[model samples]
Target: MRRSSSFVLGAVALACAGPDRDAAPASPTSSDATGTSGGSTTVSGSAGTGSATTEAGDTNGATIGDTTGDDGASSSGGAELGVPMFVAQGMVGRTTVSCDDGLTWIGERSWDVEGDAHLCGSTTPVDCSGSGSTCTQRWFDGSCSEEACDCGHSPGFSKGVEHGAGRFVATWGWGWPGAVATSTNGFDWQTTLDGDTFGGLRYGGGRFVVASRTPQTSLDGITWTASQEADFHGDDGVTIWSVRRFGFADVDGGRFVAYASGDTSVDTLISSDGGGSWWRPRSMPSDCLGEGPGAYGDIIAGNGVIVMVDGDGHACRSDDGGSSWTAHTITDSRIASSGVWTGDEFWFWGFGSRYSSADGITWTTTPIDAPDDIGPVARSPEGTLVAVNNVWLGYEQQAFLRSTDGVTWASLPDGDFTPGHPIFFIAFGHAEPSAMCPGT
Candidate 1:
């Protein structure tokens, strides 16, 4: 993991309206732990002063090398299960793949081109496979399937999505400003141009928030506003700077928290009342301040608390929303970039090991069969857990791991991505595809 090079250049004029918290979130320092900020550099933070203790009752129920674990059908939630979708954005093309049970995936060619730009129909499929499959049409020039134009070659990268209430809003961008595609049915989409650069787009508390360089919010997924502005304070509670960028954001307890790394310190941007407004806390955790803690990973919030963990085996808990933080050390350290709050416990992992905690203070470790780099973990609305490993056969191929209890993981079939292109994003959710193209 590395630190981001971008910084707030001019003096920030925004006011600091957040609470006087004890500490902020963690930053990455090692190659294993990457920061949420765009740039990758060595991250450093203060070490925890408290003693590290291991849990007594071992939770190691499954074999560490077993990849044939049972599919957790019993833990599936009441919500209707949709197609499991994954997006692979290479240097040239963006591939959207869907699976029924996550064991197999079928890629959807969102765009294609001939001598002249012509939209491929169900009879003549383009980049995706299938004889009679009508691929979901997406246009780069703000034109969806309604109009026929020759500008369908650039299928933008699908950044993230917010789905609920029979609606699906997916954000995508590559070079230019970000845009959104809203769909009542996940198959066909209506594209809208957005001002903010989309990275970590999230929807919570009835509002949508984008954690881009210039953070923006929207009541609906279309009309966006740059309302999340605040001054960042260092651990000393005096040095202030403008928030230039944000990363790793989550919504819980009616508050939206986004991590921001500074030149010398790290801070979190907080928004209460749904992404309508934002602020930064006064104080920060001494351990999280002044680059040296080793490695910062990701943030997960649930069960009335927000927890941030680093690759150096340190964990910080913020109980009063984003006000203050308490640091704790894990006995066994695992480098993890993504974590999931399973409504009962927190699970974070990297390659071979998995870490879990019920109270966010005392944590236990469970070795897994994962042998590659796990980037992000997504839980379906039906409670099925899916994790994406960046490397399977090599760096080119990607693998999917499924778990029902967040403990035992089963390796699914490998994704047939382009030979040298790596997958940038992965997601699993419920989608109501149109009757024309039922998912495979």
Candidate 2:
């Protein structure tokens, strides 16, 4: 119970993504990582109705010449509550580089074990010992020696990692579900599935898919079952909010077209035979006119054609398989997880313009002057392109930061990313600070 950031707040209950690239591949995200801000006020319409209050992904605090209170203490980190990010500084310390927005910036480190030593979990393989990478839990402090509080650090959302033959996979997420971890040389990693593994673990040709919202399968990523599962409620149930392999990826004949979400509808989930068997959704153009509430992102097949995105920033395209779809322009929206070939042609990211789409349908936006404000978007098979800056209180000290193109950035937070991978949604936020935006 250490109090400083105003009597203390909490986050990082659990995280997942393994396979020894280390951390940052538990993918699948439309974030609200729940930084738990508390007390601040005002939230508007749209985005449902707003009012949910979670703030803290990046809270440098006030800027654009100072907002309401302007100096709670936030130099380059004020906004980013949703998107707008900046972090890059290490060279001799942070290491790992390859910019130009192709991504490949692995940094962000934290220990949090109270500092010295005291978390002998998993029998203490040197602390967290790297089993399936490392994801231990037990923070209680409720008194009478129930103290186990091991903030051994967690938020490892990286945007890089590619281990071929020796094999390694990490597409983040666990507290929100969807997890994947598999390794051969990256480390001893073992756990294979947990939840929300969409958006950044698509191996290609030989094939290996990730985006588990009930749908699970693992021939080699290291043991996983549950071919396809769903239950967003609805029907006589009425819960609605289905989302399975969210977006970006298109192939038509050999088959591998996925972009899911059922209850609210916006479909296209055909796996041909590679992804085992998938084909029970549709609507890319059942007749595009416009619906009520929508949320979709991640499918980006490119050149061969298949672009589909969401958060309303619009980047829809289909060529012929999902029936029909055409609309592309990503200024900003929710774009949670992205990829399409890599560079030059199609590279979309959320949190207001981290874009590139040459053929996906015209787009260029690329402006990520981030001190901290990256909401969604993650890519790194080789094309690089990382801009994940989400930091609340503990990842230890620094917070999250990394930027390749979109305009220079680097925060390090400390330094991490050897095998770590958790690209759940790496865009960025916080632009309103120009005196909150109006003509600043």
Query: Which numbered prediction scores highest in TM-score against the true structure?
Result: 1
lDDT by residue (224-284, candidate 2, tens digit) is 5565543333223443233333432334433445443332333345554445545533333
TM-score of 2: 0.27
Minimal lDDT window, size 10, model 2? 63-72
Question: Cα lDDT of model 1 overall?
Answer: 0.45
Per-prediction TM-score, please? Answer: 0.62, 0.27
Report the number of the highest-lDDT candidate.
1
Candidate 2 RMSD to the real structure? 20.6
